[model samples]
Target: MGIPLLENRTSPAGARPAERARRRRYALLAAGTAAMLFAVGGRWDVPLAAWLFPVLLLRFTRTTGPWAGTLWIWAAHIAAAAFWVYESALGSGPVVLAGAAALSAVQAVPFLLDRLLSARLGRWTAPLVFPAAVAATEFLITLLSPFGTAYGSLAVTQHGDLPLLQVTSVTGCYGIGFLIAWSAAAVNGFWQEPSRPSARPAAACAAVLAAVALAGGARLALLPHDGRTVRIAGVSPARTVAAAGRAALARIPGGRQGIAAAPPAAVDPATTAAQDDLLAATRREATAGARIVVWPENAVPAQAAREPAVIAAARAEARRSRVYLDIGIAVYDTTGPAFGRDETVLLGPDGAVLWTYQKAHPIPGSETYKPGDGRVPVVATPYGRIANVICYDADFPAMMRVRADIMLVPSHDWREYGRPHTDKAGLRAVEGGYALVRQDADGVSAAFDGRGRVLATADSFGADRQTLVADVPVRGATTPYDRIGDLFAWLCLATVPLLAALATARSRRR
Candidate 1:
């Protein structure tokens, strides 16, 4: 009796050791997820990383329970995509940490659903279901995000791959994301059951890839490049003084309108200096045979409409150099406490104002200006139909809906966020099938064609005064995305609930 009792006690201890081993396995799995996500973030600059990211992630999370898998998915996204959030935190504080964690949670919902659906569905359905869930979530984010930004999307990673990126013309970025996610899921399915893996998923994935390649290849080959090319130059000033700062007397290299006196009471002297700098830069570009000269966002401290001197200087420059000018300025009215419109004005070669449009989207928290009533205007120019949008406005695809040959973006970015900010906005060109010319004060200024190809770029951090000159193709090709809009996204959204129901029924059956 005593020997039997001792053996029973030893068995309980042995079970405890097994529990410890199980806990260790979970920890290792979480660590692996973090590593995979870190690699995925490199997709922003490294195109190949996009295809390679989901292999480990889908494989590791497939075996876990829904709740645990959700947590792991959150961890993975935080590891990969939280660099921007962390950078947004000016200092290391508890608030920043909590904010970052909250952002990660919000972003993880789609990936969590991907894992959960894959677990519930049979191997045959996992590949299709998983990508649908991700597409649905991304579509919702575009609808709900403050500025309608799809910034961290995996599709943007393929911006460098012109053949692949042309897919955006049909289904927008969501289509590209679906293909990548599907491939990852298929790869995961193969790894899940190596010896008895089903051939159906692999064959299906290959068909989709082949179809996309063929379609994109044909489009690139057949698309007409018959439109006239416009010689555009972007003028980016290295430093800008705040509205409150004392005006410094700086001589513009080519223009006579050097820094002038400040307006009485309302205007700051710094406004005069900023205008002087923009006019000066314009002169230099115009001298270099640039027919259109663009200035960065907030190049003029005050609104050009309200301030005569600001418009006067720009008009003089435009007339003197025989070039078109697109200038960004802030408009103010004495209505509310924070009343202003971030606006862009287009001046023709004759120095007459041709068209003006307010920015549709204003960046939240960072910008205090009230959002502009949604308006997209296309101006007829000798070069082509031109559309104007401010920095944050370019983030929203819907805001970019217009028939235009070229889109002008007057942008401003902090030093740390230059490349990512500029590169991400380039996707809009692919979606809308328009060439993009962006001027940034403290970021990477770039010109991207309708195919999402970077023609020329200038790094502001690399020089005090940076300029980009490129002959951008006029918008000749109308994309299916512009015609049909978010049809694929809506389809995924309607399918997600059905997928969830199927998953739930499958879970119960098991």
Candidate 2:
């Protein structure tokens, strides 16, 4: 026998009111759960919540009329987005709210698609619709949106779960998202139709997840860490020095604008003390046996004219200390149309300039630097094949797919985004099978092995000095994702239309 229909016209007219009331309760619960768990930074961000909210929301939509379901889901999404904005560093301005609303509208499309298409298909094929829609939406957002994969990715919520995260090594983060969405769809199917055959899909999803976890665990356990390791150190200015520099800059005549428009002579003095501190820290770390040293993003701020001198000082330091130095600097240009340049200049032991990489994806509204050509720079060193991408560039998986042993990310973040942002960057290490060293100014800095295991961490906010040292593997592991590159997301995107057309054709036959 088919499952008992709830609240539809097929039900007795007298029972309709109670059924609708029950479904409304489900909708409310779904909305509340989504609001609690949707955002990146929040107290209620439980991983299980990511798997659960979708199920309840799907059930509510499946039982309701198309228009009612669409409206309710949109409202739920809007509430979730607003909650996220409130928790985030992004201020809740009218423009941000409008953008969030627009994004919420897009986010609700998967639910609408599931509501419209699932009933038309057979039980075996029905559960695929929601996941396909969700994955497609996420993939499109990552591909086309300027925000990149910084927001709306369910995989980010599950960053703490390493075993499940290994799926990203093959399918990118989109695979993990797909599995989560598929689990929701599968569970809902089993909930609606409590028959033996209907249970197979849910069981299959569980099996797949279990298999993924087992395989991931095996990979993590079996991966040889006995290989050669290199000592690397990440450095940022002392809290006191950083504060003093900011104070000095704040005294400029035009306030924030003055720092950018001020003459090189005026800006140089303000930042000189902090830059000296960072260079000194690098020398100290190098003395302590760190062959490669890194400075946090914009650890040195200089005017365009003074930047050459800044580089010359860093080069002299690296040459004297006989260490490789990755120097992060912000070069302000008073005459140029662009505000400044945010970049990392790599210097070899011989004081030779290796490669200079500019930040490719600057944070949407906050950063005004001219972006780089989106190419990751990799060079072979004695330690390993090293690659560098500054800060927000790590968020884009497509750009981060370089075949390098070590990925150096120089970042700067506020207190609210520090740990979560670093954890998100670590996922790229797992995906690319490379050791990742993220050195952050005024935030949490971290280093992770290729298997996503933490090597070391330093919180600039908590510590007096932001200096982190870690021994990371010299050789990078090979992963399927690095070669195939988003094939699973592409497949998910391709399946949505085919499933919809099949469902449409099948509905006509009935």
Best by lDDT: 2
Candidate lDDT scores, in order, read 0.71, 0.84
- Where does the lowest 10-residue lDDT sum fall in candidate 2? 35-44
User: What TM-score number comes out for model 2?
Assistant: 0.93
What lDDT tens digits, residue by residue, belong to model 1 across residues 392-468?
A: 78777766766788989999777766666777788888888889999987788999988787989998878667888
> Candidate 2: which stretches are off by over 4 Å?
1-44, 253-257, 335-337
- The digit string of per-residue lDDT tens for model 2 on 228-298 reads 99999999999888888777777788644467778767787756887789888998999999999999998
lDDT of 1: 0.71
TM-score of each: 0.84, 0.93
